[model samples]
Target: MSAMAAPREHDGADEHLMELPSMRNPDPPPPPLPAAPPRRGLNFHPAVYVGFWITLSSATILFNKWILSTCEFAFPIFLTTWHLVFATAATQLLARTTDLLDGRHRVKMTGRIYLRAIMPIGLFFSLSLICSNKAYIYLSVAFIQMLKATTPVAVLVASWALSLSTPSLRTLGNVALIVVGVIIASWGEIALDATGVIYQVLGICFEATRLVMVQRLLSANEYKMDPLVSLYYFAPVCALINGAFFLVLEAGQISWVNDVMGKVGLPMLTLNACVAFALNVSVVFLIGRTSSLVLTLCGVLKDILLVVLSILIWQTEVTLLQFIGYSIALAGLVWYKLGPEKVLEHLVLLKQAAMEGRALGVVAVGVVTVLLVGVVWYAFSGPEGGGV
Candidate 1:
């Protein structure tokens, strides 16, 4: 009986070991020299093979100016009306195409989760657009672009306050660089009244705040519905809410429309509509692709390109200081890109790891990203006298 029991125990042990094969190591292969780690290389997408990003970004700025100059009505109102229309239409069309191609569920909105998910995002999206458009009115496109560079700083502050994320000293240094870049970019215009500076700062703060809120909202909740489905529903809601606001509270100021919208022709309307649509889509894609810091910096890039184009096309005056600031900002961008202790790569890696379910790695990468950003902010922060 003892021998039989022993045999059964051995059989059971073999079955258990077979079931947990992962715990065992396989036979070793022939010994060989260790392979070297792969070298890091700078790679660009196919579309960016010929500096497509630079080209598209430059084009975006030119389009902004063209749309603004072409439209007769107040910039924000016209932007709001057409942007929503185009976004709604575009997303709906895209959704139909996606469904037909993929044979997925046909854009169902029956879930309560869908409504809960989209409301905050849709609202913030519209608010951010409105704030940015309004800021353009109060500030020079250059000044606004300069101040908008502080978006990274805003996001860091929000993260620290909310305990959502912690940023490193390097990141903080980059934020400082951004502020300096903005100030240097606008140094020529610094002679303007203090009120103008205040407005620019406020605009920057608002845009930054909006960005943080957007990131937070997007990250917190997950809806079962498709992204296009949500976008399709959210668009009309945003348009309706913003349209109502424009009508009720801002309607009194609508008298300016006739002066600006004098004989709105089809061609002009089509052009403005296209501009507004492109702006929204580009911004959305930019935010999706990179950090808000990157988005803001991209704005700086766009502004520089626009300045050059504006000078060439319109012969606009760009003072020497403005040129210096642009140079400094571009240099800072290069610095951030090359520095080993930068947050950009770490942040990208962390984001990828999070998406891939490597939680432990995410923690390490996120910490590194934050530290790099903080360092960047500190290095680029204001000078000893507190001036950018």
Candidate 2:
């Protein structure tokens, strides 16, 4: 009787222990999250930078065209001078008046550096601006943009020639596609002006040379500058050069009769300058945060939009061949951005598959190839298989 009683007592104690709230299952507390890093300046969504750059660039181009062509301003030199002058004044105001741009780089502002290095670059810059603006007078914005699509070719060639970048056949081949596309576009142009084409080509060359020189000079000096600092340094020199050209070449051409400001009034001109400087700031911000590849893709997208916008706003007539060629050039730009090694690997696999047994890669490649070809055909030829 005693042993049975003891066993019952032990069982009752165990049941009581289980009934206590402390003995029940409970959820574990959540792990703590790490703190976020602080942003340096005004916080913005990443798209802000890209959006501003694209819109500003497009606006500047359109504004310049309207001033020089439609308004019959016919003063490319003076207009360029105004842009540089405004940029210089605005940059100085931001740097000195406001504390916006760090504004405290310690570059050696020697006369030698200014005359030998900066002056030459500014000369090329001035010429490039003048020529591109002049081209706007003769060629439709759509056509001019189509020609500018070959900028990558000029950049790659110049970079390789200057030893700023390594040479690669794959790179060359990719850019060759771009050149081929531009050729096609040129062939199909409705209003091909000799002077316009010459101006465009000269502008491209000058622009490419300026880029290479910048890389070489700045890198050799171990000096890296944000776009603002660059503008601060170069704008004055560019302004002086452009101003001289204006006095020499354009003073007599302007009527000075239309309130001395043409159709785009003084207020509008000031707004344009503000937008242009904002674009410069946007470019600096973007390049600081993103990769070169991202910038290239953004540029390609901007070009495409500019072409379409030209058609919509200016009623620029785009031929089927021009559209097809622009598409091909854009495709090549995409390929170039994919990296040369990866593109070659795919191509080699394609060839090997053709020579040997078909593989999964071949099927994938064939599918993409077919898809691209079909799209091109459908775009160039009408829905009913007739040429446009």
Candidate 3:
């Protein structure tokens, strides 16, 4: 009996050891099979966004010029009012129909905010548009573009005066370079109009002030808005303000039945309005997809292209002195925005690349040198009336 009991006890101990092994290592459930990353939908490249913005902006400018100058509508205030009214209606339609203007919902806008913040900005916006459009009647597109290079300088001064930015000597110097360039360009302008220049200058001041005010509005966390939403809020007020100005200034002069409906047909005017509104939509995409640096650079490119287009389309005369001055202003504008550190870094990279015999750096330097030489030679030897 004792031997039988001993054998059974040995068997029981073996069974317990097998059970323990099974309980301790249960295979970890096959390690959870690793989740797949979510698939992303089609994303546009930054260049696409940049190109869209440039095309729309150029179209808007050219279209407005055509309507105001070539088409002989000549009434800037009326045209401006029409644009704002169309913008107001379009934004309202978009808000009702699409998710595009949903950003406006995020803004904590109250009546007080609208009265205090938006109305003032809209007033300046109206003034800016009126004056800018008026200037187009007198100024050529190339000269207008060159003059606009000073906008950043005006904005900087406005910011300082409004106490939004502290005064900086370095910044002042950078912007001063832009002023010098614009002055030189102005000097070289063959069809310079003092009246047009005054209008443009006033427009720049109003625009600068509006931008500063916009900065202040956006500083608050509650008031965050993209370009479209800002337009949605501001457009109505601007339209009303522009309408008032139109009634006061252009009501008697512009017989809408004759001037608008007869000369510029409804289809043409509607198309023009659509292009203008599309430009604002493009701004939404541009600002959303790109950095501020990209926007600044693209703006510079757009302005340059506009100058070229003006020459091709309208035979606008751009002199060598004007080119030199505009180039200087653009350089100053870039320097001001990018700062010394970034500029130095780029210069260092170029130096290193040239030293290493890279094709890109060497080619860039060569191209720039060729351009400078060509410009100098043309200025010295070209005919008095001949221009780029």
Provide the TM-score for each candidate, comma-separated: 0.59, 0.76, 0.82
The TM-score of predicted model 2 comes to: 0.76
Q: Which regions of candidate 1 fall more than 4 Å away from where they truly are?
A: 1-45, 48-60, 66-72, 98-117, 190-203, 218-234, 255-264, 276-301, 333-339, 342-388
Q: Which is the better candidate, 2 or 3, if ranked by lDDT?
A: 3
- Superior by TM-score: candidate 1 or candidate 2: 2
For model 3, the superposed segments whose C-alpha errors exceed 4 Å read 1-42, 350-388
lDDT by residue (1-388, candidate 2, tens digit) is: 0001111111000110000000000001011111112247856765676677667767777777777777776777777787789888888888987644453354556788778888998898888888888888898888888887676677667777776667777567767887888898888887789999999889878776776666556543334444566778788999999899888898877766573465667777677567666766555455434444445555666676666566656656667788788778777765665566655775786688877867765665675567546444543453344233
Whole-model lDDT per candidate: 0.44, 0.63, 0.70
Model 2 Cα RMSD, 1 decimal: 21.9
lDDT of 3 by residue, 1-388 (tens): 0001111111000110000000100000010112112224525786786788677778878888888889888898888888888888999999999877887887899999999999998898888889989998999888888887787777778878887677787778777898999999999999989999999899878877876677667656567565567778988999999899998999989886889998798899889888878866755554445444555556666777777677767767778889889999888866766676876777798899999999988976786677556545544454444464
Tell me the tens digit of each residue's lDDT in model 1 across 1-388: 0001111111000110000000000110011112112223523332232233345445544454444443424456545655577667776676576431121253344557446655655565556555555544444444454454454455456556655556567656754565576577676753354654664455445444443433443332232222233345666777876687677656776554464456454466566555434433332222223333443334344455555454445444445565556556654543443343545675677678889989787665575466434323332351321123
Q: Is candidate 2 or candidate 3 better by TM-score?
A: 3
Q: How close to the true structure is residue 159 of candidate 3, measured as C-alpha lDDT?
A: 74
Q: Arrange candidates by lDDT, highest first: which order?
A: 3, 2, 1
Model 2, poorest ten-residue lDDT window? Answer: 16-25
RMSD of each: 17.8, 21.9, 21.6
